[model samples]
Target: MSDLDLGVIGNCAVAALVDRDARVVWYCLPRFDGDPVFHALLGAPKDAPDDGVFAIELEDHVHSEQHYIENTAVLVTELHGRQGSLRITDFAPRFVWRDRLFYPQALVRRLTPISGSPRIKIRLRPRFEYGSVAPARTYGSHHIRYVGPQTTMRLTTDATIDFIRDETFFNLSAPLDLFLGPDETLQLGVKETADRLEERTLVYWRTWTHRLATPFEWQDAVIRAAITLKLCTYEPTGAIVAALTTSIPESPGTQRNWDYRFCWLRDAYFVVRALNRLAAVRKMENYFRWLMNIVASLHENDIQPVYGIGLENKLIEREIPDLPGYRGMGPVRVGNQAYEHLQYDNYGNVILGVAQMFLDRRLLSPPNRADFQHLEALGRRALKFYDQPDAGMWEYRTRASVHTTSSLMCWAAADRLARIALHIGETQRASEWRASADRIREVILERSWSKKRQAFVDSFEGEYLDAGVLLMTEVDFIDPRDPRMVSTVKQLEKVLGRGPHMMRYEAADDFGAPGTAFNTCSFWRIDALARMGRVEEAREYFSELLKLRNRLGMMSEDVDTKSGEMWGNYPQTYSLVGIVNCAVRLSRPWEAII
Candidate 1:
């Protein structure tokens, strides 16, 4: 009976999700794709003592409220009991230290009594290797160390150790501080350190949000979405995760969940594009370095659709059978299978992700001819695979067909390469790439378009309607105002649109037809609607779609149109980025506001 009523706190190195009652339910140790140290979000077995959680439970708890501390990743939760009330402040410290970015792999919590005498229990359960190992514990006067085979975690706190260890409620007279992170002694007292880190982290986040060039309208919502998007970034490697937790189902009573901790090449681009719209250049630059490392490491033209944050290419798909999933949906997967699939659109996405680096004068390191040469290799692969496909962007498990989205991305790769070549004064190379782009575009227009149905279908020589065809205008493959493009949008609306939602597609895939509407696709629908001169309707749907975000202005991968419950991975980057993009497209100009 668990829900997605969670708020996230992070420092780009590690993140944790805090449930409504201020329990740290989901936390990964050391890094984003690392072991789940606090795994209660994906619960343990039925009647298994509810392991993998760090909870501060108020005795006789009646109701609670949770929210972020304005324009920051810091979260505050209030618990009200019959006797008294207390406030819980949670955040992972992030700030500049020693003239460098200091984001440790840690989470900090502060408990302050608000009213009359309040008693609370501390439940700190740290699991290892996906809930297979329960670590042995050792304690000092002020800290407890959890030692396991894979990792050792420490909790340094000012609270009573016996009360925490024995799960007994204790009277709260003064504020308490708990710092859970690597097994290390605090340089200072827990209270002073937590307070200092909280203040620094607050300043850091406010400064970060202050710099964002958000649209005047929906300023608060846009800022929250942008901050969440920033939290999903693994700063050391510049890899942005699709979501924080794994195995959150796409809908109720379904096994449609997959681990989303890894960085997908396609998804990373969209995230970068969204941040770039707000003039946030650090993520783009760091991600460009990450992207170049991946490109440089490829001995051949081969690239994966997803990889570990550190750029490790081998992401073998597997399931941890022992760990029960979100709300007891089992089969908690670790690695992703999409890494093995040939998602052709990734080629274009890669080039598009870094294409601006060549032209943006603000970049510290600009692309040189050598980089273009390597990209030419990718363009050749694009040309070779534009008309062929192994998996579409949706990652169909059992089928492989020539998808229109694949061809469009390949065309995008060539098209961007041509522009890059022109910018670098390589007319000959530009002409060649332009020709490649033109040839690919012709085939896409010829094979993907359906004459009888008057719309572009999902695959070549196929009559199935899909929301993916709406990307034709997104990548500039077709004008949004074109008659053919207009008809395709109309057809998709009839076939896939549900109220303000839009399904990924109507046709059955390896997992039968999708039930929850893909939230990202619905944003894509808004863009199409606006571009096709349906501005008022587009604005209305955009406003409606904003309601699907959780109380913290966070979104997921999919949403049930009828019930309005968000599903899929929590705080999905695809859905979050859609908010920024749609806002930019639909917002009134700054000139008008000024």
Candidate 2:
């Protein structure tokens, strides 16, 4: 049985998920939101013939191992057979070329013989409409064009055309380069183009990693996590996807699957905060631009929690019936209905994302008075909805409550705006925002705390606990050492904690009780513990949580704490954010080593 030990390769334009066996299992072409071109991860049973998978498998396969080149997004998988072994190098070409960045929405696989004579088989099955339609193929001298109903792709390769087309076995004698990209003939031959791309992409990733101001501890883990996060960014639009592939269930058959391919304003705060801490400005700057566009496009009371990467407003949910889901589960979903739901927490997030522009002098073009006026409009919305019932951060489908987390963030928006106003020398506006923040603070303290429970609950006048409340100290809604915060952590640990992993909440959700621990919640636990002066305990728990990452140092959205298997969407941005933030918070100061 395979674990969720998968490797991801992308060029900030597109991404793919490859298993240990070197199969391109899950990929969306042209862009992250485009229809699936390779959709094997949401499968039609492993033994079924022509299951719409893309694999370069060895006929004499024995075993295989997968890993990344150090500090890079490039992935290498070594497959050993009874007779011979082969190495596959997988990446999407992304680098600076001719004074411009060249990042094509393409996947390149280079197969080389390691030892002995290796017999290999090539299977390229590109699907359309979320694996509901198989593409018709037309072949030429050195290329194969796969034409689907809505999309077309071309495969340019150096391998024998007959062998690839027929899926026949061939003995490997030399290198074979396969470039699967948008429907265009390769100007240069496959081998030469692939060689140049491999060299440049390697340099691009290394140079990009070289600029990171990593912590003194866990440098490798941080770098890998940072790269994964970068790959999730859709550079053309500057929107970072929550994850790559979608509907990989939170756990087996729980129906907790969600499409995370779009951009969520709520996630932007944490994503930009993590990148900003590392002094990586490019992602932040790009994301700010994306946000500004969304802000500029917003009408009164029309802001949404989520948007298409292109800022499209509608996302209607539907299932791909032809594709049996990940791990043989059914109902693989396409669009996410959460876009239509009310998630008031987004208003605060929008303000927080822009607040950095006003405060950070490093920004090339910081926010002006006009920018603050737009942001204050969002702040006004947060002020209106902060006390109302709506969907909380978890995006519960069937429930509504005056969620303390949402209210706290409303406070954060007003509080941060006050400081931002001060930075821009607007004393009167600063005072007004400060008054609004204080009013929110008073409301939270009066209504959200449970005198009987001796802790801050998940909602006003409710008795349940949520892992999100652990974020109280994080957003500065409450001091780390405050009695209420400390008590909330204690009570939360007893109720929501499952061993070291923390569930988002124990309350029954749309899918009933959660079957897996949301990985980022545990990271919040680690951060809270660290700030509470429980240094040794925090270090131990943090180390234990790091052990749960997949072999590639990547994490999904959740993990089955009992079986220690990762689930949810692959290479989750929130999970990686937790790693970078925790490492930065817990690592020893540079002065200790210097």
Candidate 3:
């Protein structure tokens, strides 16, 4: 393997392998939610001719393989060729420094040749505002100033980086350095005589991993997944993006492209549950604090399904006319329009997650009583519009149906509100919320279940089997062993399970076409199996899903089982969380069926 044929996708961000060389051929810097600064995964250089911003051409390349560190966020790509074998480690340091948050701003690509000397290429392209604004570069011996609107990136290199027109590219045989200034001045340095960057990277990763308090047997994998999850989390706002890049079609050349880098309230409960399972209290605390801020800032009726990093509620969707999409998929987009769509299920998800946080005895400090009260007020207001049709979890194109998932979430909200009232000693409020929750549950059970199908339907009157119903087990709305649950799982397996991977639903009905199998849904099935006392089946399915992880132990949003190509966004947080959660569940002895 002389060529670096690697790719990474997560939180809607997609990156491609340039070659065996350590250089990142494709990457959108600053944030995954941001537009592309480097986009080569979509197609050849011709499609995005004018939009071509940053391109690195490496020298003395060899063999390379990408892998995540044992239990941390660091990504390592080992390269070996005619000159020597060098290890390049990439990571965004986590520990807070001087009251300034140090996240994934600086792309730390560490290179150490094991044997003979090998030259490498380095390129720097700082295109602000999604390659729309080209910055003027002023070069110094060790510094390069990239001036853009409201942001400046001071690129500092240990080895001289040759400045190209609107880009920077360099070839080096020794240590190299670079810096990326997003909002503030950033410094990067490499020295002949200095502490090992690898050692420091290991120290940073191991120290962080040790903070996890869970003693689960699958701690290694779980810790790695947790670290990935943390890396995906936007530290400033406590929002975890769905994936790093967008526009990677679920089916090649299909119209299933979606931007997932925004914060989704529907992911709230799952994120909290996974973090709590790992005993990661600090993360949950930060997330809840962010949630509180969102609730406090918005009026009850103005709540959106998602928000931008700065807590901006409006995400007007638009296409970047310049750049072509990944693998020729057209219409590359940013700023999710779905935020404007009514996603009623988010209310339930938020309430459920907050309630879970309250239930956890590990809450470092008691939540503010006022915050809880405000949350309750929001829930009550949302209930007024709960009967209205809105986009469901899939965020479909046509008018929203009576989505079973959304309705279930409504029940979840009411149930959690009742729990919240009980927690804070509000007996009267507790009784009222409890009654409301019971009513909602009754309505769901009566209206959502299809007698003809013998299982819960996707909506009030539809007979389709949606994989989302598996969440019923996760939410505790239905016992895993309930006959309905069994029937639902069986129906999904027959209808949607393609080998080990599962589809969201029968796709022929809406969205024009179905997509490649969704990796998250497959893990959900594994979880459903485990919860239903099918431990053996769960383990089998879980093992198969684990095999789908790329050579780097990372998973994408979907997989083409036929070609074994990982499609959609790379390094999807939901799939990783599902894997970790399911693994944890399966690691335990088979408890009595739920």
Residue 217 shift from truth in candidate 3, angstroms: 4.6
Whole-model lDDT for model 3 versus the true structure?
0.68
Any runs in candidate 2 off by more than 4 Å, and if so which?
1-3, 45-49
- What lDDT does each candidate get? 0.89, 0.87, 0.68
Top TM-score model: 1
Task: For model 2, give the 10-residue run with minimal summed lDDT.
Answer: 44-53
* Model 3 TM-score, 2 decimals: 0.89
What does candidate 1's lDDT look like per residue over 441-504, in tens digits? Answer: 9999999999988899999988899898887877888889999999999999998999989999
lDDT of 3 by residue, 1-594 (tens): 111134342221222233334445455555666545555554323433434333333345545676777765556667766766566655544444467543445544555555666555555554556556767777776667778775566655565545433344333355553433344443334442123444554676677678876434556667767776766677666776776666667777776777777777776557767877777766777778778888888674656788875677888887766556775676777778788887788888777767766666767765867877877876786566556677788887567788888888888888888888898798999999999888888888888889898889788878888899898988889889989889989989998888888988875645564768888899899999988989898888888888776555567788876665788765677887886788778885334322
**Which residue runs does candidate 3 get wrong by more than 4 Å?**
1-21, 25-30, 42-60, 98-101, 132-134, 162-173, 182-201, 213-217, 507-510, 589-594
Better of 1 and 2 by lDDT: 1
Best by lDDT: 1
For candidate 1, give the lDDT of residue 369: 93
Q: Estimate, for each residue in 165-264, the C-alpha lDDT of model 2 and write its tens digit.
A: 9999999899999999889988898999999999999999999999999999999899998999999898888898898877888888878778999999
